[model samples]
Target: MDIIVTIFSTIIDQLQKPTLAFLIGGMLLASLGSKLEVPEPVYKFIVMLLLLKVGLGAGISVRDANLTELLVPAAGAAIVGVLIVLLGSRTLARWKGVSKIDGLATAGLFGAVSASTLAAGMAVLDDENIAYEGFIGALYPFMDIAALVTAIVMAKVSVARRASNAEIAADGTMAMNAAPKTEPAQIEGLEKGLVKTILVDTFRSPAISALLIGLAIGIFAAPDSVYDSFYEPLFRGLLSILMLIMGMEAWARLSELRKVAHAYILYGIAAPLVHGMLGFGVGLIAHHLTGFSAGGVVLLSIMAASSSDISGPPTMRGALPEANPSAYVGTSTGLGTPVAILSIPLFMALAAAFIG
Candidate 1:
């Protein structure tokens, strides 16, 4: 009972923060049918700046981090990413009225990191004076790419297996009782340079590119003066704007989500909480192994909870062309983001309860 009260109190406190308040305010405005909208170019610029700041901080920390400490949590992040998608494959993908392709696409987005959400989580942690490892931001790309590649690969494999079965049936090459076999050539073709393709596409994405550039500059150059004077101070203000934009956009996408399968709506609402807990469990293991901080655990859970809004949709569109965009994009931007943001304090509270 005390834990529950603490959780609720933490959530209420977090909700009052300007970053989240701006988000709720935007949602209210959009719900009221306001024509207020941030210009696309300006929104993109905000995202770039925020991501660069995160990357720069992480890079600076990584410059002196013990490699074992860094790699262990990173491996945990990668595992969590893969696990989220695979878990969705067994549950959401197999649910009635949900197409496998759409489910996997949605899973991919949920598993991938949200740059804006990450920035928001960092802002909230700062506001609450929760200390986390700077290298936490460096785990972003590992989880993002792993989830994406895993989902796309799984989707392609499923499609190939279906095609193979169809061909076997048409040619009467396999008995009804026997399993249909995909040709070696077909299997080879399905995976041919697939990982390489996804890595290229992910790196080429503007969000990831901005982050990587910031990381490289931080590691290679002496930009501490500019970082301290420029990025650090502006971080919160920029994050508030980003949160506002996300809230308005999430509210706007609600109609699209409504048009999809009802199962998707349920999954979107539940996935963040479930996936976040999974991440928290992984973080606990990391903590035991490397003395990872409670705040780092909360951030990891936040990353798992967040559905990718920037790079995921485009990557899904390119990689899984047959998947319905309305299902993945709408579910993610509409329901998942808000739930993830709202659940931040719950995870933080849990971290406090368990780790303290």
Candidate 2:
């Protein structure tokens, strides 16, 4: 009972922070049919600045981090990413009225990291005076790339298998006789440049590119003065606007989500909590092994809970063209992102409760 009270109190306190308050306020405005809307170009610029800030900070930290400290948690993050998608494949993919393609696409998004959400998590932790490793931001690409590549590969394989089965059912004798000749070619074609495509697309995506550029500049050049004087001060104000835009967007996507199967609505609501706990569990193991900090664990949970709002959708659209955008995009932007943001304090509270 005491534990529950502590968790609830932490959540309440965290929600009152400006970063979160702006989010809730935006939702309220949108719900009331307020005409407030941030221009797309301005929103994109805010995201770029935020990602660069995160990357620059992480890069500076990475300059001094021990090799082992970075590698172990990175491996853990990659594993969590793959596990989230696989877990969803078994559950969401099998739900009645949910197509396999749609489910996997949704899973891929959930598994992928959210740049805005990561920034938000960092902001909240900063506000609460929680100390975390700087290299935590560096782990984003490993998890993001792994989850995306895994999901797209799985979806392509599933589609290929279904196609082969269909051919056999249509003409069993011909398909069986030609199976040895045709199957290998089909497999080879699926494997050919599929990963390359996903990789190129992901790296070139606006958010990831901004982050990578920031990381590069931080590592290879001396940006400390500018970073501290310029980016640092601007971070919170920009994040508040970003959160407001996200809140309005989340509310706007609700109608699209409502059009999809009810299972998706449920999944969107529940997956963040479940996936976050999974991440927290992995972070615990890392902490015990490598002394991964309490705040790092909470951030990892935030990454897990967040669904991809920036990169995942376009990558999924290109990779799995047949999948319905309304399902994955709506569920993610509409429900998953909000739940993930709201759950930040819960994970932070859990980390304090357990790690302390």
**Candidate achieving the largest TM-score:** 2
Clashing pairs in 2: none
Question: What would the TM-score be for candidate 1 when compared with the true structure?
Answer: 0.97
TM-score of each: 0.97, 0.98
Candidate 2: where are CA atoms >4 Å away?
Answer: none
Q: Give per-residue CA lDDT, model 1, range 194-242, as digits (tens).
A: 8899989999999899998888887778778889999999999988898
Which segments of candidate 1 are over 4 A away from where they belong? 173-182
168-242: candidate 2 lDDT, tens digit per residue: 678866865766666667778999988898999999998889988888888788889999999999999999999
lDDT score, candidate 2? 0.92
Candidates' C-alpha lDDT: 0.92, 0.92
